[model samples]
Structure formats: C-alpha cells, structure tokens
Target: MSGEPEPGLVPEHQRPRHDECESVLLTVDGEQFRVCAQAGRPGAYDFDWLSGPHEYGFGLTNSGGLALSRDELVQAIREFLAEIDPATGYLAE
Candidate 1:
C-alpha cells in the first residue's frame, strides 16, 4: 500500500452511509499507529482486529449513543490514545 498520508484529522463532511473505507497511519512515540475507518450500520458494529498489534480500544457514542457517527468515532480515538500507558510507547513525550 502507498505510504502517502491520508486526509486531515477531521473526518469527511459528506461521506456515504456504506462507503467509509479510509485508512491512515499515525506516528506516536516512534511507533506507527494505523487507523482505519469502516462502515457502521444503524446499530453497533462488531470490533475486529484486522491488523497491527493494538491491544486496546475504546468505544464512544453520542449523548445517548442514539447512533454512531464518524465524528464520534474520531473523538473516541483521540480520547483512547490520550489514555494509553506512557510505557507502552503508544504515547509520546
């Protein structure tokens, strides 16, 4: 796959309901963090470990989790990364 960086940290403004397939690599603490976007239906989507050795994950939703949105997912990723153990190297100085 191309090493080219993906779009900005912001999620796409007008993405299709079933066409979320963006992937990006994030460098943290000298390690590469790979984040991929998937399509979620009206309900919850099953969590799967497609690639990498990420052993931690966090799930966040709307005020009531009425439905999962791209923005919410991105926010969750940011929060999760913030809570990673410093020794794990998932976090940087």
Candidate 2:
C-alpha cells in the first residue's frame, strides 16, 4: 500500500522460507499487495500472496525455464486486485 507494509500484515523481518522465491510489495490503484514469486522447478513458478487471510495468487513459467518476468508478476497481482473489492475486502462482483 504505502512505502511500508500494512501493519500486522507482515513483520519487518518476514522473509520467504525458500531461497528461490522473492517477494515484493506492489501498489495498484493505491492499494498495496504483496507478491511472492518462487522460482520453483524449471519452467514453473509458485506464486502466493503472503500477506493476509484472504489469499489471491497464480503462477506462470515457460517450459524453456524462463523466469517469471516483472510484468508477469505485476499482472498476477493486478488480477488478484481485480478480484477483491477494496471497500468490503471481498471478491468484486
């Protein structure tokens, strides 16, 4: 959301358990969403929202072992955002 993580959503020291995965705080329409991308097996990525009770995520990778690009990551988060109704914190109709 802001430059800092939303209170209680993440601890200051919170880190991904897996070394291959990296996390970033993404802001869309002024709402903050944490996106984690795991460089799992070749040609696949494991994505998750490691921020709250309402989890929204997806993954994409190429069979050629291409890593998840920044655009892809943001797009994933955007899709997640589209599903959530910010006012009510529920799925958007």
Best by lDDT: 2
Candidate 2's TM-score reads 0.47
Q: Rate the local accuracy (lDDT) of all candidates.
A: 0.37, 0.51
Show how many residue pairs clash in every candidate, following the order shown: 0, 1
The residue-by-residue lDDT of candidate 1 on 10-40, one tens digit each, is 2334332333644444544344443444444
lDDT tens digits by residue: candidate 2, 1-93: 211112222332443455546666666556565555544555454445555345444445455665556776566566665666778565556
Give the TM-score of each candidate: 0.36, 0.47
Model 2 poorest 10 in a row by lDDT:
1-10
- In model 2, pairs of residues that clash are 1-32
Candidate 1: 10-residue stretch with minimal lDDT: 1-10
Q: What is the lDDT of residue 62 in candidate 2?
A: 55
* Model 2 regions lying over 4 Å from their true place: 1-20, 42-65
